[model samples]
Target: MDRSKRRFVQALGATAAMASLSVSALAARRTTWDLLIVGAGTAGLPAAIFAAGRGRHVLLVDAAPQIGGTMHLSSGQMSAAGTRLQRSQGIIDTPQEHFDDLMRISRGTIDQTIARLAVGEAAETFDWLMSVGFEPLAGHPVSGLAHEPYSKPRYYWGARGARSILEALGPLVDRGVAAGRIDLLLEHRVVELTTSRRGAVTGVAAQDAGGARRELRARNVLLTAGGYASNAAMFEKLSGIPKFVDHSYAYSQGQGLELGESVGGYVRGAEKYLANFGVILASEAQPAPLLARADFYPERRPPWEIYVNAHGRRFIREDMQSVDAREQSLRLQPLMRHWVVFDQSVAERAPPLIVDWEKEDMLAAFDSGAAYFYKADSIDALAGAAGLPPRELAATIEAYNYGVQTGNDFLGRRHLPVPLAKPPFYAIRHQGVSITSTAGLAVDGELRVIRRDGAPVDNLYAAGEILGSGATQGQAFCGGMMVTPAITFGRLLGQRL
Candidate 1:
């Protein structure tokens, strides 16, 4: 087995050991639960915690061996307006402002009702985390990072990223389990949603790794089972784009989406599907592992290389400051793929293009025959190796070099450090990919799973990425929109349900 697969197996083994109760034992004890929360990660954990806190009997289950679903992998960045933290910092902000900023960044494509609800309740949700001992990084609450900047400095994350959130939530969940308010079941995948004859979701049928099947009834079923970014087939079917990389949580296999759809719940936001600028994959295979990401942000590293599509045309200004603009431009390209082309001189003199990698490490990639890294003495040879049009590649570089010499770039690029006149041209293929799922099960503002006719699926609710990243973020990635709304909506559901 390869090292990555081996490490994954080892991690699963450790997670399995963390749970002591057998599936049969747990299933035998609880025939009915007040609330059945699926996927004990970001949204489920909060739902379970808040529900149990309200003296409700909650049954929390996950296919993964342990809880803290995507939280283990998420950056854990959250944005909230009018929080104690913001107040302490004396930074005045409001939910309306947050809502407006998200709409502006998303170009008003976001579900305004959902976005408004999330931002409105975000402060309380963030405050609850802080009250529970969640610590933000020192000098945090920045305007933004990779995504478009928010007008206010409301963005915040812990030093440990999403794990920092799990730290705060884990203990509360433990307390609920200890108090017998929450029945925690792990290593069980919910295969089907058991619904009433009237089509109201009543419970779930789950199977353990040992193939032991159990049906657990519930007054309400909350599908916080996360997104389908990890499932290549489902991702492509829903997003209308290929899954280019596998950086999502391993357990995010779209169970929530499937389960919801089985009971009349429909999905939305497929049109809002958008990919990140790009990332260097470990291989050319679909859904490949991420190898490295370039610092495409001009503010971070001015571009010394030109970005070209499969047709070998410079699609966007390399020095464009707006991340959303760059991403939207990439969406129009065939296969959502692009290549970073540069000559040996630019490679040697320019600051490292790949984040965290030095020039030597990058140069080694070409020598090692890395899947996405190609080197050729001529532009035509480099184009052939990288699968770009040779004629167009040469012409594109010629135009770029002419512009560099004359100081008049057609794409309005300002940072023209050097032309591609040097020998041994290099091309690094970067595939546009998204870690979060954009298409998700449709839910009402109150967090109720709804059908295409806009009718609520009784006793069925959803929170977190299962609602789709596009629901809150729209076609653009709004800072902290996904993670923050997930926790906030989950908390609200727990309190209400």
Candidate 2:
């Protein structure tokens, strides 16, 4: 059968299913909502709240019982220009500057249209948050934070983590529920989509926790279900890149993307993959999960040591201002993993390698070897235990020591000019890890889901991480692109659509 025929059959079956069920069964066996939103997260939640507040009946479904999704762990950093906060703080900025800085930071890799729209309305969204009682940290709206500095001071975060945004959204969600404008079906994962003969999405087939399948029909089907960061297999397949580590929201399984594609939506933007600079961790295994950070802001706190790959060579300036440069380099590595090597003298003389670790905790980790803590009488012995070539490792150390003593570094490592000529050398294996993906579905200015052919899928919409970080932020992380856009687009759709 043709594409239209297949959709006709599916639509007919869904219509019959809807009609055969009794009222309570129709209400419980299956549901009909004005708008069916998959993934009640930062994007999905705000969408539900805004749509339902507009008196449109909305049904919110999530695979996880909780609603926050990745926002629970997000930093909640955001960028916006010309906001009320900016006015109050006397921080001068403009949407044009925001757009220019975003493109500049991403090096024109981002979809300019999407970036333009996002930056244009971002200031309004920021003001909305302030009106809703969201407070920023002191001296917020700064030029930038961990990401590269923007041209203006327009970046800020809630004093709390991502939950701060959720907290601001929670009451609106509850109000929607109390007003009977929105129905939340938690623990239900969308598996299939039912479309009309014209290839327009009409409803979704979701499975509840009890292994029960139900149909939800709607005039509009929106997918804010997030990205495939948690699903390693799908992540690799979609992006054509190996998942170096598993470090995303466990429930972000690319469900919405899969369902949308099943109907007609096309996925794109896999070409923009980038990895985090480096991660201090406890293992060299496949999910080289993060344990701590090797933050190199010497002005605040100096780096206790340096990093080397499997070849035993430094790969970074170790003091570069460009997080993008650092991340792009790390992604080029074979498995997105690196090792941090230091000597006992540096370990004893400098601050602890793990920033948050108390002196007792550091000593315990060293004693326990939980984070590849190894002690040896010599550098070669430490290399042996750390599974690195002793000769090459020794040579690398020699060069580093020469740089430290002679003040002529090869890697331009500013701090830790001390030589590693002391006994009991230490090496902690660090890896590259991130909670976001550079690959995702391609979306247009209106946030409509599109096909690989550059055509919009009628009545199908996608937002949030499902659209991929690469499409919006490009190869670089722009602080709040992930959460802010998710929330912004979700709200925009709710009010407009």
Measured with C-alpha atoms, the lDDT of residue 468 in candidate 1 is: 90
Clashing pairs in 2: none
Off by over 4 Å in 2: 1-31, 239-246, 283-285
Q: Let me know the TM-score candidate 2 reaches against the reference structure.
A: 0.90
TM-scores of the models, in the order given: 0.95, 0.90
lDDT (Cα) of model 2: 0.75
Error of 1 at 327 (Å): 0.5
Q: What is the RMSD of candidate 1? A: 4.3
What is the Cα-based TM-score of model 1?
0.95
Kindly list the per-residue Cα lDDT of model 1 for residues 19-59, writing each as its tens digit: 43535456566778999999888888889889999999999
